[model samples]
Target chain A: MILTAAFFSAAIVAGTPLLFATLGEIITEKAGNLNLGVEGMMLMGAVMGFMVGLKTNSPFLAILAAAVAGGAGAFIYAFLTVTLRANQVVSGLTLTIFGTGFSGFIGKGLVGEIMTVDIRKFFAPVEVPLLSKIPIVGQVFFHQDMFVYLGYILAVLLGIYMYKTSKGLNLTAVGENPAAADVASISVSMYKYLHILLGGALCGLGGAYLSLVYVPAWQENITAGRGWIAVALVIFATWNPYKALFGSYLFGGLDIIGFRIQGSGLAVNQYFINMLPYLVTIIVLVTISFRKSKKNSPPAGLSVPYFREER
Target chain B: MKKQLSFLLVAALILSLVLAGCGGNKPAETPAEKDMVVGFIYVGPIGDGGYTFAHNEGRLHLEQELGVKTLYKENVAEEDQEVMNAVADMIDQGATVVFATSFGHMDGLEKASKEYPEVAFMHCSGFKMTENMGNYFGRMYQARYLSGIVAGLKTETNNIGYVGAFEIPEVVRGLNAFTLGVKSVNPEAVVNFKTTQTWYDPATEKEAAKALLDAGADVIAQHQDTAGPQQAAEEAGAFSIGYNTDMKAAAPGAYMTAPIWNWGPYYVTQVQAVIDGTWKAESYWGGMADEIVALAPLTELAPAEAAELIEAAKAKFISGETDVFVGPINDNEGNLKIAEGQKLTDEEMLSMDWYVEGVKK
Candidate 1:
C-alpha cells in the first residue's frame, strides 16, 4: 500500500505536463487544426517562464508570460494556416522549428545559471483540509502541488466546455464540416482562431508548470520531447479532456515503474519498462480504432485548412 | 490568388533566411586574419546546462587564452548528414580545426577529418582518429571516487543510488570508482544504479532519482547531465552528488559534492600544443593531478568528517600516492579483476565494462 501511494504520487508529478499539452492539443484538433508544434511551444514556454520567474520572483507572472509566449507561437501558425491557407502540417512543423530555435537562442545566456529563489515552498504539497485524514486515496489525491490541482481543474473545465455547451457544438460542427457551419453563419474562422489560441495558451501553461514547479531547474530542451508524448496522448484520450488526464497519468505511471519496482525482488529489464509509454501509446491507438463509437474518432477535418473561396 | 501564392512564397523564403541565420552565431572576430579558426559541433544546445555547457566553457577558455577565432554550431545532431553538413559549413567558414564533442559524433568526425586532412580534428571520449585528429577526456572517475566518499559518509540507510546517463564504458568506469569509494569508507553500503539511456532528459532523470529515493536510498548520485537528480533528491529529503558542474543551487539541501570538469585549462594546453605545431593523434586522458577533473566543494549536508576524508584522498591523487584503478580489485560478481599490488593501465581502464564489488546495476 505504501509503495502504491508512492507510485501514484510519482505519477502526478510526471503526468502534469503531459495532461496540460494533451488537453491543449485536443482543443486545437477539435477546431480542425492539428498543431504539431506542442514541443516547440513548450520549450518557449519553459524558457520564458524561467526568465520571468527568476527576474520578477513572481510565479503568477511567470506562468502568464509562458502562456503569452505559447499563444504567440500559435498566433503565427493560425495566421499561416487559417488566414494564408498554408498547409496545416507544414505550418505546424515550422512553428515547432521556430519555437525550438528561438528558445535555445535566448536560453543560451542563462545556461548553468541556478535559481536561488526559495519558491519551492510555493509549489510544495498542499493537502486538502479534512479529506487529508482519510487513508491511501486521500494521501495520493489530496496531497499534491498547486500545479497538479490546476491540471485537474483544467481537465474538468475543458470537459464541460467540450461536451456541455452550445459553443462546443458549434466548434465541433466547424471541425466536422466547415462549409455547413459557414452556411449557418457560424463564423468558422473565428472559432478556429479562438480555439487554436486557447490551445496554445494552455500548452504554454503546461510548460510553465514544468519550469516553475516540476524539475524546477533550467535545462535546454527541458521539455525533453514530452511535448510529443502529450501530442500522442491526445489520440489516446480520443479527444476527451478527462481521458487525457487519465492517459497522462498512465504514461506517468509507466515512466517511473522501472524505478518504483526496483529492488522489490522483481527482475525486470529497465529498458523494456522504459519503452512502456510509447508501446502503450501504440497499443491504445490500435484498440481505439477497433471501437465502434464514431465519437471516439479524430476531428473530421483535422489537419485540413478550410477555404471559403473554394467552397 | 496568384499574388497571394507569390506573397506566401516570399514570406517563407524570408523566414527560412532568418532561421538559417539563427543556426550559427557569427564567429568571434579574428585579431589576425591568419590566426587559426577553430570550430565546434555540439551534440546539444549550449544551454543544456550539462555536457555541452561544459564543452562551451572550454571553448570560451580557448578563445580567451589562445585568442583564436572560434565558431560553433549548437544542437548539431550526431546523425551522418547533419554533422557532415555542419563540418563542411565550418570548413567553408574558414575553420582550421573542428572539434566534434560527442561520442556519437565520432563516425561523422572521422568522415570530416578524412575529407579535410589539412583541418585538424578533435573529439571527446572516443578512440578512433586520424593523423590530424586527437581524442581528449579526463579521468573523471578519479573525481567520482572523491564525491562517492562524501556520499558514503552521509548516507544513513547504507543504500546509495546513481542515475547513469548510459551503459557506456566511461559511465561504467565512473560508477565503479564511485562504488569503490563508497565501500572503502562505508563497507556496509552498496550502490545501485539505473540508466536513463539519455544524456539530458530532466523529466526522466528526476523520476529515476525519485524511484531510487523510494527504494530507500538516502544518498543519490547521478551521471546524467541535468540537475534533475539533485533536485529530486532534495525534494525527497535525501542527499545527492551532482555531475558536470557545481549543482549546489539546484539542490541546496541535498547536494553533498560533485565530480566537475575544469575544461578551460585543458583546452588552453591542447590549443597551445596545436599552435606550437606539436599536436599528435594520441588519445589524451588527464586526471585530478592535472586538474582536468576536480571535486566540487562539499555541501553543508555532508558529514563533518567528509571534507577531511575527501581532501586526504585528493592529496594522495596529487602526490602520486594513489591510482584510481589499483590492485586487489574484484568485479561485482566477486571475480578477481586486478591482482594485489597491480594497478590497472590506461588501456584497461578505458575499456572497462564491469563494475566494482559494491555496485548493483
Candidate 2:
C-alpha cells in the first residue's frame, strides 16, 4: 500500500513540470502562435533560476528570474516570427538551439558547486491540516512540494480562463481565423504577444521546478529533452488544461513503472522497461490520429503568421 | 522591402555557418612553439557532478601539479565518428598525449592510435589496446565493498537498494562486490538492485531510489553518476553510499561514504612517462595500493564499527592480502560460480555477468 502511494506521488512529482510546459504551449497555440521553442525557453529558465537561487538564496526570486529569462527568450522568437515575418518553425527551432548553447555557456561555473543555502526546506512538502489526514489521496496530493500545489492551482485557473472567459473565446477565434477576429475588432498581435509571453513564463516555471525541486541542483541540459516531451503532451491533452494535467501524470507514471516492476523481483530487461513511455506515446499518437473530433483538433491558425494588409 | 530583409537574413545565417566552419579549421601552433599538451575527451559534460566531474577534478589537479597545458572536450558523444573527430581535433591542436575517458571510445581510440603512431592514446575501462594505445581502470569494486559494509551495518531494515546505470560488467561487478560486502557484515540483509539505463538523469534516478525506499529499503547505494539517488535517500531519511566522487554535499544526512577515483596521480605518471619516452601499451588495473581508487571518508551516519571494519578491509586491499572476487562465491540462483579456495582471475572479473547470492533482481 505504501509502495502504491509512492508510485502515485512520484508520478505527480515527475509530471508537474510537464503540466506547466504543456499548458504554456496550449495558451500560445490558442493565440495562433506555435512556439516550438519550449525546450529552449525551459533551458533558459533552468539555468537562470539556478543562478538566482544561488545568489539570493530565495526560492521566490529564483523563480522570478527563471520566468524573466524564459520570457526574454520568447521575446526574441516573437520578434522574428510575428514582426519580422520569418518562418515560425525556423525561428522556434533556432531559439531551442540558441537557448541550449546560451544556458550551457552561462551555467559553466555552477557545475558541481554545492548550494550554499538549502532551499529544499523552503520548497519541501507542506502538509495540510485536515486534508493530509486522509488515507492515500491526501498523502499523494496534499503532501507535494510548493511547485506541485502551484501547478494544480495554475492548471485549474487556466482551464477556466481558456474556456469560460469572453477573452478566451476571442483568443480561440483568433487562432481559428485571425482575419475574422481582426474584422471582429480583436487585436490579434496583442493577444499573441501576451499569451506567448505567458506561455514562455510557464515553460520557464517548468524548468525551475526541475532545478529546484527535482534535482535541487544545477546540471547542464538538465531538462534532458523534457521540453520536447511537453510539446508531445500538449497534443496528447487535446488542448484542454485538465486533460494536459492527466496526460502529464500518465506520462510520468509510465516513465518510472519499470523500476517498480523490477523492485517487485521481476526479471525484466531494463531497456524494454525504459522504452515503455515512448512506446506508449507512439501508440497514443496513432490512436489520436484516428479520432477526428473538431473540438480535439489543434488550433486552426497554428504555425500560420497573420498579415493584416493581406486580409 | 520585405524580400530584401529576408534575403539579408539568409545571407547572415550563411555567413555565420561559414565562420563557424572556419573556426573549426584553425591552424595548429608552429613546431618550435609547440609544448607538451595533454588532451582529454569526456563522454558527458564536466558539470554532470558524476564521472565527468571526477575526471575534470583530476584534470585540474594535473594542471596544478605538473604545470602542463591541458585541453579537454567535454560532452563528446561516444559515437565512433564523433570520438574520431574529437581525437583528430586534439591532435590538430598539437596534443602529444590524449586520454579518452569512456569505454565506448575504445574502438575509436584504437583506430586513432594507428593513424597517429607518434602520439600516445589512453582509453579507460576497455580491453582494446594498440601499440600506441592502452587502457586503464581502477578497481572501484573494492571501495564498493567497503561502502556496502557501511550500508549493511547502518541499515535498521535488512533491505538495501542499489541504483545501477546499466547491465554492463562495470556496474554488475560493483553491485556484486557491494552485495558481498553487505552479506559479509550482515548475512540477513538483502540488496535490491535496479538499473536506470542512463548515466545521469536526476529525475528518473531519484524516482528509482524512492521506489526502493518505498519498498522498505532503509539504505541506498548506487553505481550511477548523479546524486539523485543520494538526494532521494536523504529526503527519505535513509542512509546512502555514493559513487564517482565524495558526494556528501549532495545528501549530507544520508551520505555515509563513497568509492572515488583519484586519476590525477595516474594521469601524471602516464604523461611523465610519455615525456621520458617510457610510455607503453598495456592494460593497467590499479587497486587501492596504487591509490588510484579509495573510499571516501565515512560520515557520522555510519555505525561506530564501520570505521574499523572499513579500515581493516582497505588494508587488506592495499597489502594484497585479499581481493573482492575471492571465491566460495555463489550466483543468486544458488549455483556455485566460483569454487571454494579459488579466486576470479582478472579476465573473469572483467566480464562478470551473474549476481551474488544476497542480490535480488
Candidate 3:
C-alpha cells in the first residue's frame, strides 16, 4: 500500500514540470504562434535558476531569474518570427541549438559545485491541512511540494482563463482566423507576443523545476529532451490546460512504472520499459488522429505566420 | 522588399550555423614552443560528474603536472564517424597525442592510428589497437568490491538497490563483484538491480533510485553516471554508494563512499612515456596497486567497522592476493560457473556476462 502511494506521489512530482511546459506551449499555440523553442527556453531557465539559486542562496530570486530568463528566450523567438517574419520552425530550432550551447558555456564552472543552499527544503512538500485527512488522493495530490501545487493552480487558472473569459475567446479567434480577428480589431500581434512571452516564462519554470526541485543539481543538457516531450504533450492534451495536467501525470507515471515493477521480480525487459512513455505518446497521438475530433485538433493558426497585407 | 529582407535573414541564419559547426574553441596560446599538445575526445560533457568528469580531471592533471598544452572535444557521440571527425579536428590542431575515452571510439581510433602513425592514440575501455594506438582502463571492480562491503555493513534494511547503466560485460562484471562483496559479509542481503540503459540522464536515474526506495531498499548503489541516484537516496533518508567520483557533497547525509578512478597519476605516466619515445601499443589494465582505482574515504554514514573491513579487503587487491572474482561462484540461476579453489583468468573476467548469486534483476 505504501508502494502504491509512493508511485502516485512520485507521478505528480515527475509530471509537474511537464504540466508547466505543456501549458506554456498550449498558450503559445493559442496565440497563433507555434514556438518550438520550449527546450531552449527551459534550458535558459534551468541554468539561470540554478545559477541564481547558488549565487544568492535565495529560492525566490532563483525562481524569478528562471522565469525572466525563459521569457528572454521567448522574446527572441517572438522578435524573429513575429517582428522579422522569419520562419517559425527554423527560428525555434535555432533557439534550441543556441540555448543548448549557451547554457553549457555559462554553466561550465557550476558542473560539480555542491549547492550550498538548502533549496531542496525550500521546495519540499507541504501537506494541506484539510486535504491531508483524506485517503490516497490526498496524499498523492495535496501533499506535494510548492512547485507541484503551483502546477495545479496554474493549470486550473489557465483552463478557466481560456474557456470562461472574453479575452480568451479573442485569443482563440486570433488563432483560428487571425484575419477575422484583425478585422475585429483584436490586435493579433499583441496577443501573440503577450502569450508567447507568458509561454516562455512557464517553460522556464518547468526547467527550473528540473534543476531546483527534480535532480536539484546543475548538469549539461539537464532537461534531457523533456522539453520535446512536453511539446508532444501539448498535442496529447489537445490544448486544454486541464487535460494537459492529467496527461502530464499519465506520461510521468509511465516514465517510472518500469522501475517500480522491475523491483517486484517481474520479467519485463527494462529497455522496453524505458520506452513506455514515448510509446504511449505515439499510441495516444494515433488514437486521437483516428477519432477525427476537429475540436481536439491544433489551433488553426499554429505555426502559421500572420501577415496583414497578405490577408 | 520584405521578401528580400526575410531571404537575407534566413541566409544569414544558415551561414551562422555552418560557421558555428566548423568553429572549434582554440586552445590557450600554445605553451612555450617545446610543449607537447594532447587531445581528448569524450563521449559525454565534462560536466557529467562521472565518467567524462574523471577523464577531464585526468586531462587537467596532465596539463598541470607535465605542462603540456591540451585541447578537448566533449559530448562527442559514440559513433565511428563522429569520433573520427573529433580525432581529425584534434589532429588538425597540432595534437601529437589523442585520447578517445569511450569504448565505441575503439574502431575510430584504430583507423585514425593507422592514418596518423606518428601520433599516439589511446582508447579507454576498448580492445582495439594499432602501431600508434593502445587501450587503458582501471580494475574499477576492485574498488566496487570494497565499496560493496561498505554498503553491506551499513544497510539496516538488508535490501541494497543497484542502478546499472547497461548489461554489458563491464557493468555486469562490476555488478557481480559488488554482489559477491555483499554476500561475503551478509549472505541474507539481496541486491536489487535495475538498468536505466543510459549513462547520464539525471531525471531517469533519480526515478529508478526512487523506485528502489519504494520497494523498501535502504541502501542505493549506482554504476551509472551523474549524482542522481545519490540525490534520490539522500532525499529518502537512505544511504548511498557512489561510483566514478566522490559524491559526498552531492548528498552529504546519504553518501557513504564511492569507487573512484585516479587517472591523473596514470595519465602523467603514459604522457611521460610518449615524451620519452617509449610509447607502445598495449592493453593496460591497472589495478588498485597502480592507484588508478581506489575507494573514496568512507563517510560518517558508513558503519564504524566498515573502515577496517574495507582496508583488509583492499590490502589483498594491493598485495596481489585474492581477486574479486575468485572461483567457487554460482550464477544467479544457481548454476556453478566456477569451481572451488580457482579464480577467473583475465580473459574470463573480460568476457563475464552472468550475474553472481543474490543479485536480483
Candidate 4:
C-alpha cells in the first residue's frame, strides 16, 4: 500500500505538465481550432523560462516569461490559421519544425549551464487538519501538491462553464457552424484566436515545469516528446478537460513504473518498459476511436478552415 | 511544336548532366594515379561541438597532415537505411577506406563491407567486425580511473558520485574504473551511481548530479555527452570531472581535468596504411602511451597532489607495469571477482559487466 502511494505521488508530479497542456488544448479545440504547434510553443517556453529564471533568480517571473513566449508562438499560429485561413495541419507541422530548430539555436550556449535559481516545486503536498487523520483515501487525496488540487478544480469549473453557460453555448455554436454563428452575431475568429493563445500559454507553462520544478536545469530537447503526449491525451480524453486529468496520470504512472521496476532489480527488458507509456497511449487512442459515444467530443468544425465565402 | 520539342530536348540534356554529377562518375584512372579517398559517417551533427566535433577534427587532421582526400556525412541518423546507401555512395565515389563513428552504424558497415570487399571499414565502439571491418575504441576507462584519483583527493564528504549516460558495458566499465581509482587513494570513499539511459540528456544529467550531491556527494563525475553534471557541480560548489572533451569553460570554478580521445594520430596512421596497401583487420584500443587516450591539463582549482598522482599513473601505464583492473577487486555486491595478486586479463576487461568494490549499484 505504501509503495502504491509512493508510485501515485510520483505519477502525479510527473504528469502535471501533460495535464496542463491537455486541459488548455481541450479549451482551444472547444472553440474549433486545432493547434498542432503545442510542441513548438512548449520548447520556446522552456528556453525563455530558463533564460529568465537564470537571469532574475525568480521562479515566478520565469513562469510568466514562459507564458508570454508561449503566447507569442500561438499568435503566429492564429495569424496563419484564423486570419490568413492557411491549412492548419501544415502550419502546425511547420511551427513544430521552426520551433525545434529555433529553440536549439537559442539554447545552444545554455545547454550545460547550471541553473542559478532553484525553483521551489509548486506541487508540494498540503496536509489538511481533519483530512490527515483518515487511512488510505485521506493519504491519497490530502497529500497531493497545490497544482494537483488546482488542476481538479479547474477541470470541474471548466466543465461547468462549457456545458451550462450561455457564453459556452455561443462558443460551441461558432465551432459547429461559423457561417451560422456569424449570422447569429457571434464572432468565430475572436473565439478561435483566444482559444489558440490560451492553449499556447498552457503548453508554455508545462514546458517551464520541466526545467524549473521537475529537472531544475537547462537542457536541449528537455521536453522529450511530452508535448506530443499532451496532444494524444487530448484525443484520449475525447476533447474533455475533466477526463484529461485521469489520462495524464495514467501515462505518468507507466513512466514511473519503468524506473521503479529497474530500481527493484527485477529481471525485465528496460527498453520494452521504457516504451510502455507510448504503446499504452496508442492503445487508449484506438479504444477512444472505436467507442462511438459522443458524450463530450471535438468541436464540429475543428480542422476545417473558415472563409467568408465558405457558406 | 518543333521549338517546344527542342526546348524539351535541351532540358533533358541538362537534367542528365545534373544526374551524372550526383552519381559521382569520373574518368577511369589507375589506382596508383588516384589519391586515396577516405569517407566518414557521423551519428550526430558536426555542430554538436563535442563528440562528433572531435571526430571531425580527426578527419580534418587526416586531410591537413596526411594530405588524404576525405569526405563525410554529418547528422546521419544511426537507424536510417540512408546510412547504408551513403556508404555505398562513398565507395562508388572512389573511397578506399570508410570510418563509421557510431556503435549503431556497425551493422550497416558490416553489411556494406560484405557487399564491397575491397573497401576497408573501421567502426568505433562496436563489438562485431568482418574480415574487411575492424573495431576501434579508445581506452577512456584509463582516463576515468585517473580522474577518480583527483575526485578522491578533493572530496571532503568521502562520497563521490557518477552520472552515467547508459548502463551499457562501455559506460559501466568507466564507472567501475573510476570507483576503483577513487578507492585506491581514499579507501573510505563510497561511489554512488545513477544512469540516465541516454547519451545526451543535459536536464536529467543535471538532476541526477543534484540528487547525488543532495545525498552527501561532493565530487561528481559523468559519462555523458554534455557538460551538465559539471555545471551542476559548479552550482552546488562540488568538484567535477568532465568526459569526451575539455569542458573547463562550462564549469571554470569546479572543473577538474577530462579524459579526452585524441584521434588525429590514429586517423593519420590508418590513412597511411590504406595508401601503402598494408591496411589489415585489427582491433585498435590504444591508451596514453600511444596518445590515443589522454588526460586534459589539470585545472588551477584542482588539488596540488592531482598532477603528481596522474603523472605516476601515466608512467606506470606507459611502462606496461600496471593494469587498471588488477586483482584484489570485488563486485559492487561484495562478490570477490578477482583474487588478490591476480591481474585481470584483457579478455576479462572487454566483457566486464560487474562493478568493483566500494561502488553502489
Candidate 2 lDDT at B281 equals 84
Q: Candidate 3, TM-score vs. the true structure?
A: 0.95
Q: Say which docking band candidate 3 falls in.
A: medium
Tens-place lDDT digits, model 3, residues B1-361? 8789879978998998798767656544444568788999998888888999899899999999998989998888878788888888887777889999998888878888888899999899998878889999999999999988988887788999999988889999999989988887889899999888788889899999999988889999999999999999998999999999899889999999999989999889989999999988889999999999999988888999888888899898899988998889999999999999789998899999999999998
Q: What is the iRMSD in Å for candidate 4?
A: 4.6
True contacts kept of each: 0.67, 0.78, 0.75, 0.16
In order of DockQ, best first, we have 3, 2, 1, 4
What are the DockQ scores of the candidates, in order?
Answer: 0.61, 0.69, 0.69, 0.17
- Which regions of candidate 4 deviate over 4 angstroms? A1-24, A44-98, A101-180, A201-222, A233-301, A304-311, B1-37, B67-69, B89-95, B114-119, B128-132, B276-278
Highest-scoring model, TM-score: 3
Which scores better on lDDT, 3 or 4? 3
- Arrange candidates, best TM-score first: 3, 2, 1, 4
DockQ of candidate model 3: 0.69
* Colliding pairs, model 4: none
Count: clashes, candidate 2: 0
lDDT score, candidate 3, position A116: 54
Tell me which residue pairs clash in candidate 3: none
Residue-level error in angstroms, candidate 4, position B238? 3.0
Give the least accurate 10-residue stretch of model 4 chain A, judged by summed lDDT. A115-124
Candidate 3 lDDT tens digits, A1-311: 32598899998898888889999999999998888899999999999999999999999999999999999999999998888877999989988888888889788889976555577778888999999769988999998999998998999999999999999999999999999999999999999999999999999999999999999999999998889989888887888999999999988887778787774666788678657767777877788789888788778888888999998
Evaluated on CA atoms against the true complex, candidate 2 attains a DockQ of 0.69
Please give the distance, in angstroms, between residue B359's alpha carbon in candidate 3 and its true position after superposition: 0.5
Question: What does chain B score (TM) in every candidate?
Answer: 0.92, 0.94, 0.95, 0.88
